[model samples]
Target: MQNLDILTEDHYVLSAHIFEPRQNNRRILLINSATGVKQQIYFSFAQFFAEKGFTVITYDYRGIGLSKPNKMRGFPASMRIWGTKDYKALTSYIKTNFPGYHKFCLGHSVGALILGMNKDSEMFDEFIFVGTQNAFVGNLKLRTKIEAYLGFGIVQPLSTKLLGYFPASWFGLGESLPSGSAFDWRTLILNKKSTNKLLEKSDDFSRNLTQKVFVIRAEDDLWLTEKGVLSLLHNTYPDLKPTYRLIKTSESEKNEIGHINFFRSYNKKLWKIIFTRLEEGSHNVED
Candidate 1:
């Protein structure tokens, strides 16, 4: 695994841990978690991708993980303090520095949202949304949903306001949801109006963005559902070909896995299937 060199370390202080294979030809950037989850969460995935001849780079989002935090602001402030700008800077760094590489991106949850927010087409050759769902509806159980909203939408914000940072136990959301992200997420659920406005500003980014989108969903995901995923795909540009598949249930469990544990499937069949698909050299978007 090759180490990442920090390029443009300024207010955003962009940084990444790069894993370049012995025979590097393709570049795949892992957009890290925004919920203060460690970049190490994706270390195994990085190693796996690097071994496949893809240059993999994973880094912490601003105010999360190894990257420095901006404590100058409080809760929601800290959450919105970076995100879009950091990704923009990171994309620029990769394009300018890493030439002669087929670029791809795999973003998780909010990481995927941020990619949509940036709407930069020239940044990569293809984009993969892993663990991404239509919207945040907690889980199958109503109680889980309530708990999430209370913990994330309500209690978490209150905690951030009082404590100056998001409480860690708040189910990975932390205190990042302010009016902006929260509102954006809400609009995503309610309709595509929010995404439309954001896209309108990007100056026909859809034309540049080949419809080839790969969305990976968990069979037992508590948040995003098949219905939501379909709705989201419907709102996306028609030219982009978006593919959705369930993370097959394990033979032993006879049930599916949760939103997170992408690696620890009932067995390895789920991931193996995904990796195999990635290995096939074609974008489903055109069809």
Candidate 2:
């Protein structure tokens, strides 16, 4: 069954959904998505985790989805705004409300970056990152890099400056991509180094984690490249080096799933490796 609740922090109402199994489990899994994506995006995975005997919690960011939008009139809404504040609030809420369960986190893309940025906490027992990119498209083709810089570096700054904030819908052909959220993609370039620095400040947070981390990647993904992988390795918690791999051809060719499609795709096989990683505890999954 599914339950709904509200968690208010930093003056924003975060809408949370809980998926419970028939019997209560001692473990609870928190699913965090990339910027602008809603908690609803993880309905299937939430249900799957619940069915596997984990109570699952999913919520929207402060300025996105059902939660309250950032009320500031003239400032762009970057992922940095919501990542540090909203995720910390959600983590605190879960640690307080579900103290009995062994908490775990599953972060997708930039969601992993946000988790890496959080202050010290024992709220999460383990962590999994899907499609996490460490650095901004460094391994991508020259044209792709150019487009990112031009789109984010030039256009984003100008748009946010002129409009106070980028609109929620702008970019691509018929794409309803959020303007301020995408602009924050530029922040990724800046924060990539900062994320690494965060680990140094809290030596124990990285060294004393309760469970090891697992990283899953898709080979066809244009986002996280070899350079990003290096960055992730550099910043990861001590004794918790991530195990990772590219998606296999069988799933990719059959489903034509790429990047975001891995989560959004309706193929059960896509999650088989993920489940296997969870079962093995310390195993690294890769293509």
> Per-prediction RMSD in angstroms?
4.3, 4.5
User: TM-score of the candidate numbered 2?
Assistant: 0.81
Q: 5-95 in candidate 1: lDDT tens per residue?
A: 4543355454578887888655555554634456777778777767777777787665555664455244232222334566666677677
Error of 1 at 69 (Å): 2.2
Residues 1-287, model 2: lDDT tens digits:
55555544555566788888877656777888765676777888778877777788888765566664545344334465455566777787777778766767888876776664465334565688787766555645567677766766777678756666554357641112345555556556545453454334333244445456777777766655766765665555445556776685466536455556676647556776776766555222211
Error of 1 at 231 (Å): 2.7
| TM-score (C-alpha) between model 1 and the true structure | 0.77
In the predicted model 2, the residue pairs found to clash are: 245-286, 246-287
lDDT of each: 0.57, 0.63
The C-alpha stretches of model 2 lying farther than 4 A from their native spots are: 1-3, 68-78, 172-183, 190-211, 236-239, 282-287
Error of 1 at 137 (Å): 4.3
